[model samples]
Target chain A: MEEEAETESITLQDSAAGGRIDGKWGYIWGAYSVTWVLLVGYTLSLVLRGRLLRRSSGVER
Target chain B: MKLPFAWEHLIGVIALLLFCYGQVFGLFMVPPDAHMGDVARILFVHVPSAWNAFFVFTIAFVCALGYLISGRKGFDHALEAALEVGILLTILLLMTGSIFAKPTWDVWWKWEPRLTSSAIMLMTYVGVVVLRSVVQDNERRAVWSSAATILASVTLPLTYFSVQIWRSIHQIQTSPADIDAPLRMAWRINALAVLLLATWFLARRWRIAARRWELGDAPPLPEPLQPEEV
Candidate 1:
């Protein structure tokens, strides 16, 4: 049983590593950057909204 | 209340700055892919957006659960805001993924497991939104929205495990346990981006809810009475 499990694990590792490194690093990175843009944009939006809310609330301290 | 740059807001800003730094490192400095060329760059955006959508939805679900268990209006409002942001992120994910898919798959759409599950996930969130809008009273809206949020969580696990549960052809290059050096850096950056965005949206939405609460339970402004004949 242990031997069977070992073999299965090796096979899974092999399958996981089967892919050749594709040459499209640019697109992969671009997709990542797009996510960053969204994040930054959203953060800025929150900051703006927070400011608005505080002003409206007029709660000191 | 006090100037909006509370500690949380400051932390959010710092996190966002770090996220930007990561984006620059991931996009410009990262080496190109040997197989997919520049198109591989799409993963930086597409993967992160998809993950963020799921993260937002999960938060929404938890908030809804909090409301159900504790009956806090804050939790209800948080659930609503989280759902709103989740829907936005999900829509962005679908659009970006579609664009990425077109070049790689040689077609506009494919009924693949991830894509299909994501569609279902989106539909469930939309239903939650509709339920919230239809309800009249604030408490009723909160109750209905919370229920919808809780129920919609069913789609979350499905969307998350869809690839593993089914035989998916889409490449599963990045796993947390074992990541290649280059891909690892890129993935980390993408994650940072998601975290920053999620924090920003949550904080902003929370503030909005706080503001609404502070305003008290006043009924919405009656149609402005036209100035009575002067």
Candidate 2:
């Protein structure tokens, strides 16, 4: 089992070492970009929601 | 053009700073992985989101129980807040997982146990939200939503353990100690930042719930630490 696992990891390393996987920067960029945009958008929405709530309720904290 | 940052908002500012630092470090300072190269960096955010989503959902589960037991509006508000933030993180987690998967797993999605369980988790919380919206009566809404939240939360542990139970293709839960030095540092920093960020979001959401209650949508919260029956 350990030998099989080691062999699999070696194959993974070979794939990563080769230029075949070099272009995976797209996936990395996509993941991080989505994270930032969604988080920022959510935060903005919360701020907007808070502003509206304060305006409608007339009580600011 | 900005309001003064209050003491309560300090955690959020700090969280944002830490997030910036963590992301930069993860993206540039860390070495590429031997197995997945730079693509492994996605785990810096994806892992944190996944863990924190579970943490926030666990909070909601506790709040649900608190509401069911005490009939306190505060608990109800907290439950609502936690669920909102939890759902947000879950979306972030799943979406990033997809983005990461396409390259590594060679598919945007698979009906793997982990992914399937996460879908169940998301829909259950959404159902709780729908339950809240349809019930007009405050008491009924609170009780019904609280009940639904508790039931929905059962899926939390299921999703959390899905990888382990089913031997999923999804990565198993890992401890920082088990990781290499640089990767562990990035992971730890990002995880803390995400926790603080989620806390800030939950606080803001809870405030919104309170303002909503004050606007006569639901009953007002009882005195702090004095959770009266709803």
- Put down candidate 1 lDDT per residue, A1-61, tens digits, no spaces: 7975575455444433444335544445455555556655765666676576566456421
Candidate 1 lDDT by residue in tens digits, B1-230: 68754656675667767767766766677776544445655666677777878888889988988988898888977887898789878877887687566656655578988889889999989998899766767777788888878888999888888866774545543556664578668867867766775776776787677665555543323233578833
Structural similarity to truth (TM-score) of each candidate: 0.77, 0.87
Instruction: Give the residue spans of candidate 2 off by over 4 A.
Output: A1-20, A59-61, B1-6, B218-230
Worst 10 residues of 1 chain B by lDDT: B216-225
Please give the distance, in angstroms, between residue A27's alpha carbon in candidate 2 and its true position after superposition. 1.4
- Give the per-residue lDDT digits (tens) of candidate 2, residues B124-156: 998998888778766677889888988998898
Q: After superposition, how far is residue A16 of candidate 1 from its true place, in Å?
A: 17
How much lDDT does candidate 2 score? 0.85
TM-score of B-chain for each predicted structure, in order = 0.87, 0.90
The most accurate candidate by TM-score is 2
DockQ of each: 0.23, 0.42
Rate residue B59 of model 2 by lDDT: 92
